[model samples]
Target chain A: MAVPPTTSRTAAELATQPACWRRAADAVPATEGLPRPGERVAVTGCGTSWFMAQAYAALREAAGEGETDAFAASEFPTARRYDRVVAITRSGTTTEVLDLLAALRGTAPLLALTADPATPVRDAADALAVLDWADEESVVQTRFATTALALLRAALPGGREAVLRAADEAATAVAEPLPAALLSASQWSFLGRGWAYGVAQEAALKMREAAGAWTEAYPSMEYRHGPVAIAGAGRVTWAFGPVPGGLEEAVTAAGGTFVHAPSDPLAELVRAQRVAVAVAEARGLDPDRPRGLTRSVVLGV
Target chain B: MAVPPTTSRTAAELATQPACWRRAADAVPATEGLPRPGERVAVTGCGTSWFMAQAYAALREAAGEGETDAFAASEFPTARRYDRVVAITRSGTTTEVLDLLAALRGTAPLLALTADPATPVRDAADALAVLDWADEESVVQTRFATTALALLRAALPGGREAVLRAADEAATAVAEPLPAALLSASQWSFLGRGWAYGVAQEAALKMREAAGAWTEAYPSMEYRHGPVAIAGAGRVTWAFGPVPGGLEEAVTAAGGTFVHAPSDPLAELVRAQRVAVAVAEARGLDPDRPRGLTRSVVLGV
Candidate 1:
């Protein structure tokens, strides 16, 4: 008899990241409602999606696309005028995103990238770019978040090559073993710079959601401010993208392990997801149902 | 023999916050380089000042004072054009702030708000607003951060009254005895909404910097996403502004203490500063000089 697979819904979802990213990136050319070059843009989301929005905003601005700002959907500045507003929601049913989309209907053209196309966002958004293939059954998001960011990344100049490289890296990361330091660390700090800061934030969130882990995220430069005080013995500080000068040495001096790889930041995030799942299994928690969370934050019924 | 004063420099600095706020609010008219109404403004700073910038930016936009954005000094976008750029550096010598000020000399009108008037920023920025009276002897910021924010707040519509009211509340908060629960919490999570989100971030920073406490911060609404997974016994979640609906009950359900005060957010920040000092004293640490930190981050000096 074949051994029953112990893989959780989240682990299965995590495994499909490379393929999902490739599909999303490949579909960007035919997709509509992406912000045009030189158009001022604002991106909004909540939770995991918010981090993706931040990454996309930083990536877009760094690409010389235009000035872009990212905000939590609930905190979206209504007074500010932007040429385009992009909303990222995995479930297409978060109350805050829907409310913002409805509020912005008359003022700014709104584009929504969601995993589910048959939901209320279809009517709320002015334009919809649905990634039905990336939708997940797990409560803790994995593929959908990366797929949304991949779609946005692919829309920018030289974005396709970056996405393809990240996808290739994700494939290798999925099969590789996680570092022993990453498996049972007492605490973790995820650090990133520019666009990668969003990836760092997502990595921290994944640990919290999947394994009830005490994790934190910060801009690589900001990590030195106060958070580094906690970086001693049995803790890990992982950086996405380029490490700031002297950071690794500082963490080492504080007796904390520092992890970095040459892989693309998106691929780095895939490895983080695997760690989250592994940690969850070690703790006897089910990644498919993260404690005290829902698939979507649908407030007020 | 007379008993020597044991009051920490941070405590003394904290004690003067209400007065500093009043002075800064009253001095707004004479304070040049304040961002004007109907101007697109961006504020930049590092650490505590960065949190204050976020507070000011959100407050500015909420006041219908045109679009405003806040960024970490190291992360400021040179590609984006703004009508005005405000850099907050208490020492006026931070490498990142000085670099940005020098780089933005001609492109956009630059404003440097600092406690020190005689510094390189004097040569770098086009305009200067000095709050030398609020400058602190302690390495951890208290008065200057609040005072600078007061100046920014007082420049907005109906701002003086708000600042004056907050000063009065600060006076009360400064005198009151802190709750016993706040003194011994093993871990903390600070939450805030809108402009108060910045206050939450600062509160968490103060705990970490002053007492070596493990703390985290997030927009109040975003806390439910994943961070709350670790919010159990001996952990505290404090909200600077109005508690989100059902959040208090949820945190309580998770066996965590929730703290919310009726005082203005700025006044609430004063109480948090007191907690920082008390925690530092209990841990036999000096708030006057945080570990691995200088008054200003002067890199490569």
Candidate 2:
């Protein structure tokens, strides 16, 4: 069987995540472009990058680090003044990010984390932190997004230890084969709490991108509100982080498989990434170049 | 054939939206609990209410009223100081809203809009705006949520005219039958731009709640980045507002039905609500009592 390029490339990139996370943690001090402890900040990105921004913003705010807001690049409120604006783009050339950075030039300090330092984002941003080592050959991003998140997480108080521990767990998680039932499930719902809500959204996006799978995500507490109606036999409800009391029982009663492993939320995301690749291979799809998608969206201005 | 109580109630409530909206618009002066023109505000809610909060926040900020943020009630950053915090809950007894209001009791002026003024939220809030007439007997909310939004929109500059126009369009929308193809589509993607993104998200939630349909929502521009991969035959892509350049062509190219009608975005949402009910009736599901859900979540403290 010919292994698709996307499968092999995505797997290889995912496997390097532990080391990438460690490097990102170590590089935090040199990366002065990140937001200061008390600075009000807005983080913008596209696709997977935007989801990571959401996680970082939630985490930063939860840590009492000051106000941090996340927005899809196109939706960033230019009228709002922030102490700093951080852009996360692996390709470093997403049209919206560049346009936003250009528009905000001289108005506020701008920082960007990208895998490609050679791209125009280097010029658009006032400062840049390049994670070239985490760059992927596949169009479906994995290492770069996680590594960028790891870099941001490390900047938070006590985040270094958490990132290191999560990296170690991710190393183990990437090795374990995805559950057959999970891969074969007719539908999936990824649930999370706090910062992990963004992780859940990204996990759902990964499944849709890599395998065209039917997937949904929601804040754990909000799942029972309406989304649970879709939960039943042949569906999987995967939770990241601790869930509200009785959630597991509720999912079970609804006839859905409830998956909650004792791992860091970020580590659980790594496992989800692995499942996406496995499902893609199983479905005979090329995740590296998903249908009707490009690595970077550089629309004509 | 006897109509399910949920369907009939939901339909009746949805049909009253035009009147509800008009009343809300007229009551803008009496709605003293709403955010002021330049006040930095945070709006919080859960489930359907949260989506409406999102729509209102975007609309408020876009109208250049002030910096507005929307958060799920459970995730609101208590540490951040806001000039005002607006809580939306039809039942007025959702535990998260009550807890949040309690937490911010002395810190910031808190406003709550609820259909049930008799509930605990009335006491928890610093001020209250009651939309008792918009309350629903059905577990699945339709009128109350949109009516609350209409109330907020009316407070914005020039919003009265827009609301009146949308209310008129909604009246026509509720009377029209849903598209045959939309009712039968195996999957659906609701897309929106700017403030309408929240409407799309709400529409997708409505489908999941009312019909247990597989649905997704995304910012219209971001859909092509990865989500469009899921678009294909038997799927529908429904846009709430004017789509970005080339989006319709892209959805069609991916073999999905692209739905865009010339109507106010809020009016378009009324059409979506009608479709959800129709689809639920076709699937023999009682939308008003969706599985594993309640009208409001009141977790024990």
Candidate 3:
């Protein structure tokens, strides 16, 4: 095999992948079966996909609509009981995920979310959701992560559609070009609030994977504790949501730069996604067609 | 300032430093200022110290005692609320942690856990618990990390005397040395159970900070998720506790080498400390005194 040289891709192309995500989201209806309000729902996956599952679980818990727990794919079924399993994998071919899906085959309903609809993980799942919006080059995930999150948002009932629309609109607002303040800074620390804590984690992981950069994520409050000392002049911080003003203030007070995504209708999450894509590009790693990595795992595990 | 040559130190010496940890056992009086059951306790430190605090918090939470939360010093009081603060610092002087202590400024009872008691953190704290064990000379912390955790075990109620006794026994047990399998492995992963999850996190962080190695920490069960797919015959897993037979069997079946710690009294954590210390030494770093580091901070941020 030849060694592949590095490359880049566009987040816009990746965002348009809702058609693929739609297929995966549609499968949820059948594969989701019927989960009781209190039924135990176990969500698992790897890398950013795992973080997405975690975010979904947090949102569900916060909404008070479901009994959900998130676990690393390797740690599932080790403790407690589950009535349903939701596995998110962009590649649809994660080996450990397949192993877990196999174990849950008879034990509970299995829902697999991925960008590659035909991968083994999808095949093993009773239902599949794919956020097919992805770049061909970058090994680290970007648009697919957001689209998958959007699909998760779409799955909720009631005001969820509103949130989805908000997220979509927010995405549009921030996508064209990140403000110079957010894009020009040398470093970033992503802070998430409550249900969005998992989002912060996923953002950090994505930054590391796609950009090979050192980015730290913490609960909004935790940042104020000690990390604030490092927030000197010119440091850039992206605050995830509005709950933790103390954290943002700490960064700003440190003579550092701050970008607060005003609580516009779905503006916060969308702004986060757009800024992340911009950061990916600023690091000289293309958001489109990133280097030496792929969107799917077709090779056997 | 003159540049000093990097020298190696033994794990035991590095771990036993008074400045590196707080021997909260009988070392401190359970006076009025001492934390009571259910009182919110905030643990803060930076980098490796923060990881140790995280492990301690997890353990206390698992033990069903202590209202515990851990934070990177930078995110402390600015992020969360606490009645009592436990600050861990190998070098009694992490700028962020010290700044955190200063910020708290008599707001809550403060306990400084450090290798050096004379440092400003200790001098300013309401009380202090010193490890004075395992002095090392490396920029990367080894023995100090484990010893600090041992000190945390002693601080929790109920098993102080017993756990302290076990620490002595366990410290002696550290004599067995790391397993041969570990010595030969090019890459290693750490897994912890229950509160030990923090240990796994610390181990992974140390690997990165000291050796610039690629490592990860996860709950024992989480490993079976997607990462296990990447596991093969050559992978070495250092499990942090006596996992259930079934979980241990799964790890073995995955074709990765599995090393289990004794559970009779939670021997995994002790052994892990020794393994980490030994590895640091093997890498030609000192377990006693790594490099470019110290046990206390007095005049700096």
Candidate 4:
């Protein structure tokens, strides 16, 4: 089966992606040649890619003008109403992504964030921002997830510049002495509320696919519903941003190991990918590139 | 390491309990002994027990005059909103169920349903519906789940006499030529919209916990966001009553199998429980007896 070739790369290979990091950092900017106020835009992706789109919508709403909405690549046509539809496909050749863009034809402006600028999805899009640079060698997503988060953060209003700065800062942090909290945990659960709930699902899906770990994602308070009964000292409960509705307290009482990124709405989009990357590295596994996986596409619908 | 006792029994055993079934059924007409309308009623249980409460709430709503809410044993206090609560502890000793009732002590009326009439939860309840007659040896929950469903159905307005009449008919159907389609190659995704989302949650939780199968429960259209993308070919999607928007066509277009329960809500509850029972029996597993687990108190504050 050729084991699908590990796309996750070690820290050493990751260090070589300065130019790629720069591009990812630049992609989410609110400068010239980028989206403007009231310019109808559509963001679409599959799995974590789509979650990044959601984080973008939330950041925009928080910023007070970025009128953006997210659509699953499969559900875009009916749900999207925009002058330009941004198609975020890492692999560039996922059957559904290609089929969707083809269905849209030239009816609207199409953009692609892909690993391969020359692949079919990018070819379908009117413009492309490639993330192939930060992609990993392992079968899971680490670099790409962070890169997508960085791009969304940069693109959100007010934080546009902050996002780019954070992306660079985040990239640097992954290589530094971040706490090794997640490495020893046997299982992980992503907790989010409201907008973050959707992100939790995608994060859980990514964690399982990338690390071969058993993970579940849920709304924070929903944990007390029965899932909390399973939590104990060694379990990890990673929380996303906007810790609304007394969710953190519920997690604490459940006796779960907890970690959080600040309440920057952008944090939720990026936290999982960043922490997972560092944890993978600490475990002596590569997060930059995963094995038998591509920076762009694998098992994605 | 002794195997846990089963709470499920054969359809034959349920047939012998016609008297208790009739009493619970006939009690519905008087409404004299039941809690007043709008009184706080808290329904608590795990897996199938939770589903039975959901069925009761739905029927109560459709019959147009009861205020009841269902909560997982762990979610009791946070979402608690009743002046009177009914605790459905089948064994009368499920650790969490007992704890949940205790947590609500003094605040509302408590009704306990148990196979053990002398169990603590029953002794604590303002009233008790003893279901000791529906005992079984199966670790899977067959007879009890169905009996709970039947009792709830009989307890609803206009349902008292009808459900009792239907119970014998349902039992006959279970014993007769019902197509034995348990564990179809098709994975099942149970969906209920709005208030029924809780029911969906219970269905997925029970199916996975009891059968160790991959099952999901979500709001009908909410599945379209991401999970639905992977659903196709070998997946069965069941929609509870009052189909949600966009679901009918979406299921068809996605190449997924779909089934809607028959018109009579009580009958639907009856049938769904039958389907679950049939699933347990076909696997040669006792639905009545769960292994290495006990029905006990689950505390929530």
- Give the whole-model CA lDDT for all candidates, comma-separated: 0.88, 0.89, 0.59, 0.56
TM-score of chain A of each: 0.97, 0.96, 0.80, 0.73
Please write out the lDDT profile of model 2 over residues A62-97, one tens digit for every residue.
898888999999888999899999999999889888
Selected candidate, larger TM-score, 1 vs 2: 2
Please give, for residues B1-301, the per-residue lDDT of candidate 2 as tens digits.
Answer: 3323443678778889999999999999987767988999999999999999999999999999999999888888888889999999999999888989999998889999999889899899989999999999988788999999999999999999999999999999977667788888899999998889999999999999888989999999888778998899989999988888888888899889999998988999989988888889889887777877777777864
Q: What are the per-residue Cα lDDT tens digits for candidate 3 across A1-301?
A: 1112323344544444434334435544543443456666878887666777777776665566566767767555333457888887877777667877887787778877667786677569887755454423445565566556556655666434545455555546644555677655655677776556677776555554444344556666555433443455556677776645355555666678876665532345445545556666666656554332345433332
* Candidate 1 regions with alpha-carbon error over 4 angstroms: A1-6, B1-6
Quality class of the docking in candidate 2, CAPRI style: medium
Using Cα atoms, each model's DockQ against the true complex is: 0.56, 0.76, 0.11, 0.06
Query: Which candidate leads the pack in TM-score?
Result: 2
Task: Find the candidate with the highest lDDT and give its number.
Answer: 2
Write down the worst ten-residue block by lDDT for model 4 chain A: A1-10
Give the runs in model 2 whose Cα sits over 4 Å from its true position. A1-7, B1-7
lDDT of 4 by residue, B1-301 (tens): 1122334553334334444455556555543334455454557676557766765655565455454556556444433347666566566767667767777767666767677777677557677766666655444444565565556666556666666775555545444433333345236677665445555666554454344344666556445533554345666777765675556666677676777754333333344444544455555655453322223423334
Tens digit per residue, CA lDDT, model 1, A1-301: 1112457989888999999999988899889889999999999999999999999999999999999999998888887789999999988999889999988997988999998889999999889999999999898898998999999999899999899999999999988778888887989899999999999999999998999888889899878766776677899999999988888978898889999997899999999998888888887888887777888887765
- lDDT-superior candidate, 3 or 4: 3
Model 3 residue B236 CA deviation (Å) reads 18
C-alpha lDDT (0 to 100) for residue A146 of candidate 4: 49
